[model samples]
Target: MNGVSKVSPGVGTGLSKPVAAALSIVDCDFHPFVPLQEVIARMPARARRSVQVSSYAAVLGREHNRFLIPTGEPLRLDAVPTRGGLAGSDPAFAVADYLDRWGIAAAVMMPIQAMGVIAWAAEEVVNSYLAAMNDLFLEMWHAEDPRFKMLISVSPHDPDAAVREIERLADKPGVVGFQIPMGEIGLGSSAMFKVYAAAAHFGLPLVLHPNSVDCSLQNSPSCAGRVTRSYAEHHVLLSQPGQGAATQLVMSGALERFPTMRVVLAEFGFSWVGPMMWRMDTAWQRGGGADGLLPRPPSEYLLNQLRFTTQPYDEPGNPRDLVPILDSMQAHRTLVFSSDYPHWDTDRPDVVLRRLPVELRERVAKQTAMETFGTRLGL
Candidate 1:
């Protein structure tokens, strides 16, 4: 709010010439940040006071992204606003820097800190901070630019509060879906059923964001049962939690209970999905309908309810080798393009387009995202 300019008309105005051909692309995983002080200022006095005493770093979790990169944060140096503000802190600048640059039709704003707070902060603090952050983005970003979409940030710790938050903002313009932080709590746990039900009622899907904190935190159970020692280690195994979440959703019969519910595993690699599906289907058949919970083979549930983002795209010795795996997973229907914008490892839309086979490019880039989100994206 301090240094960011108010958004104006004519997105892509910053570019010397418009790249009209790329305008149909939808970026499913773009990160936007609000200054912590701004979120603090919007909070109730009680929550403001409580958060003041808590260690901000501990409350937000130790962000390895900042230290892992040379720029003191995971952001690309070029993504920082030319007007002098942190990367992703300014919505108007992000429009010019990312959305405009790539001709992205809409870029979903995935606020990592907001998602992290849901996992790390006190219940009251988490609720209060999330409410304030939601309002901040609604007014500061969404209201200003419709091209910048958002996900409702909710905590799995308090299902009632999470439901209330979902109901409060589900109708807001540019709010596409719900994002829950990944931690010890598995997505398919009974405690999460209420949140899942609420999302389905509103036609909003749930998004799971895997993080380094979930893998290393002492109290939170790691998917691997051991803490990661380095950024690379954490990054490599990042998809494990996503795999676990997807497994739970299918095996626990969450999708069966809520037929309309959908889940998006964002920023988690898609390569593992093909093998995981095979393992799940085999286990489901051998275990007699997953102990009477699942009604069909696990892959059936996954194919109908789960979707994945393609970023940090899997590259092998031969790029052509990826075709069969992509086909096995029905990637054209399940995979969506994500730029992971502003991060050091961000992918360019054109680059991702080239990596994908010509037949799958259109759907992966835009169609799947539109189908996954439907009218919620206001596409």
Candidate 2:
């Protein structure tokens, strides 16, 4: 327990049994929701007024087209809380439905409401929303259950403000990491180096949640530099931002600059990572665009400090073909299991664990997460 911190009982009698008694799996990408009104209540009067007049839809996006069919929320119909709200809005229900059932020892709660708003919203508005979100998650969600560790949300629009936010809540119980939506700004931008440096200093890993804005707005360019016409197109191209993030972090020397800071690209698939790394290394050797920026090979930095989640795990035409791709990507060492619980296309732990080759299951389920999150997981 030297570098690691354990979660102690909070107020009520905790879960009926120890969280570790189950599978010892760590879910790296679990979503927890706060109602729009709840978030508005926490915002400053001016910010609240802005959100109230504009409404959640208008404030978040005016023209963004989302195509969630049937249920309409990209959420599992069965995940609706017993208390009657959105699927992830109830902490106790999430625990019962996803965590306890799957034997997840720890679940990292990624905030959902204010995500991807940084690029479009004003600085003060985004700052107020994110700060309020961090407080709300800490008080309403994590405080209710020690098993719910959160990656506090912070807008990347203001690095000074972001650093201050980090300092304010760095020591709060149940805060395990930082979640930054990769807005129009690339992760390697020097503006983010302060946030990166602070994360390194705090020993908190940073998780980059892909920004949906890229697929919706013309100004916010998608990986292909054009607006996606449909949700299916958006879903198919989700890994582009993750790939861009990994490439920028390596080639721009961000990873080399903040060697201690670990980054996880959540909800983005990993089958393409091996090929991306190979391409980066080849470019590094041939003196590609990275030029004087990188001191070591790009792949080395990625393998050392970067991690990717295994949700929407790739399904090839031939089921047996997965093992080779998994081996090529060093899945046992670099991949972490993320159920993406309550989301429509969630992967069940039992199913994912079963799908993984026997030798790699333990690491994908738990060990790699422990390694990635380090002391934050209290493992």
Q: Which digits, one per residue and each the tens of the lDDT, describe model 2 over residues 168-265?
A: 89888888889876765678889889998888888889987654544533245555746666667777888887888888888889999999889988
**Count of clashes in candidate 1:** 0
- Our tally of clashes for model 2 stands at 0
Worst 10 residues of 1 by lDDT: 62-71
Error of 1 at 33 (Å): 0.8
lDDT, each prediction:
0.78, 0.77
- The TM-scores of all predictions, comma-separated, are 0.89, 0.89
> Model 2, stretches more than 4 Å misplaced?
1-21, 52-59, 63-71, 216-221, 288-290
Cα shift from native, residue 302, model 2 (Å): 0.7
